[model samples]
Target chain A: MNDPAPKTVPLDDKDFRDQLVAIIPPLRAFARGLCGTRDMADDMVQDAMTRAWAARQSYAAGSNFRAWMFMILRNHYYTTLRKNARMVSWDPEVAERVLVAGPTQQDGLNVQDVQKALQKLPAEQREVLLLIGANGVSYEEAADIMGCAIGTIKSRLARGRVALTALIDGPAYKDEPSDKGSRSPAISPAG
Target chain B: MHPQDSITMPEETVPERGLKSVKETVIASDDPIGKALRRLHDEVVAEPIPEEFLRLLGEIERKLNGAVTPE
Candidate 1:
């Protein structure tokens, strides 16, 4: 528990409402990473928010509200996954339109490429990467959110990083000797 | 309490492999993968909350108010 000791609080507390409102952005981000499409992600967030509001009485004040919310969203994501066996594939066309076209191109790894690689990862590893690497959640908080030990979180994160690196740098984009003359540079120079 | 209160974990086992070697390769914040992940997440976080969400929250608040007040 990264949060302090829990205490009882009113369900209608203004601060609770404000915190719920404030968490929507990150919640969407987390969902987007979990589900490959923006529409699906937003839908998941909406569902999570409704569930959280209904279960507001279960929330313990002074504890980590963010972690608690994340746990709810995470549980919902997995449950949805089980119910729907067909995973949503990443849409490159939508990615091109929504993602910022700048910085990512500079590093030779565009946002679309990264997202595509991310979708390849196993669900457990993917969530660990998103929670720790993207969302900046600590090991303890991540464990709590994922219902696993901190050691498990660490192992998953390491494997995820390694696997993601392999995918990005794999033969998919590598220049082949036979086609070297005809192939364009893997990355265009920054403007 | 934890939000796992209303939810149940599905019976699934995540494979643990190469634990020792992989743990040693813990990613640094400056790593390209880390940077890309952060960029992807930050991009979404930067987006404006959709109107539907605001409407949903408003509906919930209204219901809460209705529940608290006698008819």
Candidate 2:
């Protein structure tokens, strides 16, 4: 008997699942940021990934796996929230702690602080911000994923930008980047 | 379930790299805190809850195939 070997499939299907699983780290971060808790994000991403794997053949193999997966996840996040409105923290500190894969302490700068800061934005705003701000999905793609107009994504992102500026410019979260490296300049998101 | 039917997309063709700038700039921008924020963002987005998540995924994949599990 074969020892759990993957059944022979189209090269595309096999490649797609491999890529899909690789994005788990980033997907986890997005889910946690959106849901505001580790528990919920875990569920969200698991749901999304499962859907993605099962639906891999539906995926055009050459397409951007990141955006395709985001569409699935954003769909799940909004629909589930609407049905039973699970409140997730927008505060980014909780995010950092929630998504840790390894130790972070080269300098005094704490990764956790960045997470709490991300969590501060409103849910809708945070969704765009993470999608565009981090993963690099276009505003249009993000809008499509969120089932909203591009203009709406732009508006929410603007509001999110203002909120983040106010926080990072001040001590909204502990362990600001300056606290870690005296030489490292502070970062400003231009979005 | 039919393998082809299980796949999900609005259409068969997904635009090829229509938005490369977003990920590059978003992930780039030598901006320190934005970088920091992004680093944190990437980390929590996954939650790397050790091996539990992977195990669950394997189980789901097996179940979908109608494979029997040992009691």
Candidate 3:
């Protein structure tokens, strides 16, 4: 096998820019899952990209670039959420409208249902699902990105999957009121 | 199978069976939920990224390349 790339790269390296550019699509998806609206998601992604470029000097070159970038995006997302809690909470109606407008019309209903169900999950569980299930990050990478232990990641993933399946399968399940003080930060979407 | 074979089978609790099924569903690659999640992510990833992102990165690259270094 070829020797691994060094752990350090100059800030001006073209490879770094290429890697960053390559990561934007998935990064945007992650942001979309978190923010629940395309416009807000794109805005957050741009903000994250700016922050990532500004802090590129600190990145270890050979490390998991995707995970590292995801960590930065995740951190920025939570920081923004903490600063203005209302701004980041998932909005199911908006999500449905967006998904309904997607290119694939036949699959749009199911996708819309899943997105709505995803929004109903606790923020912690929803993020875990998005990162692991949707984003296809390994449990270890997800742990690194979320700054949690692997066990915590697994636990969240299991709970998230079970909860998400229930939400999607059970149409009668109503949205619970937002309990900001709870550990889950279950934000109920406004009607 | 004889009718008495039912009595010889190992007993499984309802909750345990339910949990196992949930775990299987979660772990299964072809599970509907997993498929849906991947579809959602893939749809977004397939989207054409906005031009503004590229423009912003270009601006950054230009600024970096143009900056003078001390002799």
Best by DockQ: 1
| DockQ, all models | 0.20, 0.18, 0.11
* Candidate 3 chain A minimal-lDDT segment of 10 residues: A182-191
Deviation in Å, model 1, residue A91 alpha carbon: 4.7
- lDDT digits (tens) for residues A68-103 of candidate 3: 777777677777776787864566567655553463
Segments in model 3 whose C-alpha atoms lie over 4 Å from true places: A1-12, A88-93, A100-109, A171-191, B1-27, B68-71
Query: Highest TM-score, which number?
Result: 1
Interface RMSD of 3: 16.7
**Per candidate, chain B TM-score?**
0.58, 0.38, 0.50
- Candidate 2 TM-score to native: 0.63
> Per-residue CA lDDT of candidate 2, range A70-119, in tens?
77787777667767743643544544446446546454335555456566
Clash pairs detected, candidate 3: none
Q: Which stretches of candidate 2 lie over 4 Å from their true place?
A: A1-12, A89-114, A168-191, B1-23, B27-33, B45-49, B60-71
Clashes of each: 0, 25, 0
lDDT rank, highest first? 1, 3, 2
TM-score of each: 0.75, 0.63, 0.74
C-alpha RMSD over true interface residues, each candidate? 11.5, 10.2, 16.7
lDDT at B43 for candidate 3?
Answer: 87
lDDT of 3 by residue, B1-71 (tens): 42211111112111110000001113346556666777788888988878888898898789667776767
